[model samples]
Target: PPRKNSGVLADAMENMATFAALLRKEMNAHEDNDHEYRKLEIWTRGLISSLDELEQSWFAAAFYRKSVIAGFMDDMSPVEQGDYARYVYFYKDGFIRVFSLLDKLGTVLNHFYDLKTSKLKTHFSYFTVLRQLQLLNVHPALADQLEQIKNSYRDPLENLRKRRNAEIHYMNSEMQDDLWQRHQGLHDKIQLEDLDSHLEDLKQSLEMNCKTLIAAFSYSNEQLRKEISKPKSVQS
Candidate 1:
């Protein structure tokens, strides 16, 4: 027997392996009738690829954290110029990877629901996809499950989203936050961020990403199985 909460990164790795197997089984079942399940299969494959990248990103971030701890100078203070630079480098690396994974997942969900072709093209973020799922009026159970996932991550995701936006559209995310915090005419009082805290935030975001994917893909796989099993007349 395995401990259920071995760790977030470990749990994410296991869940992704499970999802990959499930997706492969589904794809193989429809291999010969390529025309029938092509679009759904494509969407599923995209999700699987994204999950692969997400898993890789987590692994890289974890490695970076371990490296930082094991290799950095033992006496280096966090606020020291040299030490702070190293800490910021890894912190930014990890946070951006988590954010990128989330965005990739969002793209898949958006495509899954055909949100791009809708008249309201602007409504195309992951949150938008979640909202659209709510309004679908079908897949009530699946929608409920996804809603639960969204609610579970509401706070962390919002925080990460703001940092992500700043990183993408303004400046380095850490610098952006630091700038605002240091704006009160406080020289030599600049507070260095704790690397541990940033890693924790990234880990939480990864966990949320993993959980959301498991829920969404599990539901999609179930529907796909049902879709594939129906009588020919009912399919079209």
Candidate 2:
């Protein structure tokens, strides 16, 4: 059976579809020469509008949809209806949800960037691999990136936690942006290629990352298949 978080995951997946539509709308709406057009600086960025006010703008409609839709519903509960609701996502279990979302974002990022090696200084790849394998294992083979993710993003879980805490506590988006600068570097690397040939080396290197991700998960995917088949509680 699927896990209990299926609803949350489904809502997110549907929101991704909506997000894709928003991207296409924004792309078609913008003229190529427009200063604010989201140029193809990065694969995903190319999909977003150049407007800064539209952060996570793709889900804006789903965020406020009035009528409850069928499989596509992402309706928030009464607890999340108020302004102070942001804090609700910072509690014990709430934090895990937030982190899981980050891992998902990382998976999305993986689709757009070059091969990266994890350089986690504080922890070993084994633990990080297990966590990613369990939670955000979008590609069973993404486990190869686990070494890089763990090694390179040694303390991503903690760093993201701190950044999210500051954003929630101080009402400032600075620290978060600062952290994002590192990711922006990855995007910057993509633009160094010849714009005329239409292919960037970094863009081409994404295959390495995908191979790593797939291998990482496949390392243990078969053994876990049986465990998942039996009626069992989600250990995490």
Candidate 3:
């Protein structure tokens, strides 16, 4: 079995670490903002761990996908079926975590930048936060960069979002595809979705997410650095 190594993951982890370190350093300098910075640090750490889990899920899915040889459910041996099931489980987990990780990032961005996204919608999404950034005309550089990344991976992200919604709100995502195939015609054996292609989309989504986080944290850290560098006025 071939192992997968993600350069994006490495970059994201390093960027996030730098952001956390800056948060800690600034917390000491501005005691009044210590609580807020502490919360941001915790969230950043959580994002790092979540990214690790998402990567593992993606790797496991790819590994199991390699083990699956059957094209249709009826043709699968018991072992192959088990492998397929594992692949689906991990693939679904990977995509779901992609959005989950972004939402967590959104929460941190909202707090740090004072986006006030909650007022517009109680349970706002990452996309909503992006919109809020634009609407308020704050952090335009970060907002623009993030939007470009989102647009670059729009197709894959949209596909993943559909699957995520299906898995969460309706039936199993794979089964939803199977049902569509059934609508085409009643076949003797149910065919499998394109596991490799779906995995590729998932990989793209993961990369998009990694890039988004890197851009966001890098920009935020730069802002923090500027703030900390500013000189304070002396009291008489």
Best candidate, TM-score: 3
Q: Relative to the unseen true structure, what is the C-alpha lDDT of residue 222 in candidate 3, on a scale of 0 to 100? A: 90
Off by over 4 Å in 2: 1-98, 102-148, 155-159, 175-216, 224-236
* Between candidates 1 and 3, the TM-score winner: 3
Ranked by lDDT, top first: 3, 1, 2
Per-residue accuracy of model 1 over 103-188 as CA lDDT, tens digit each: 55566666555555244555355666666667764667867887887688777667767777887899988776468666865463
The TM-scores, one per candidate, come to: 0.69, 0.23, 0.93
Can you write out model 3's per-residue Cα lDDT over 79-123, one digit (the tens) per residue?
Answer: 999999999999999999999999999999999899999999999
User: lDDT values of the candidates?
Assistant: 0.60, 0.35, 0.91
Clash counts for all predictions: 0, 19, 0
Q: How well does candidate 3 score on lDDT at residue 155?
A: 97
Model 3 is weakest, by summed lDDT over 10 consecutive residues, at: 1-10
Task: Identify the superior model by lDDT, candidate 1 or candidate 2.
Answer: 1
Model 3 regions lying over 4 Å from their true place = 1-6, 29-34, 232-236
lDDT of candidate model 2 versus the reference: 0.35
How far in Å is the alpha carbon of 208 misplaced in model 3?
Answer: 0.2
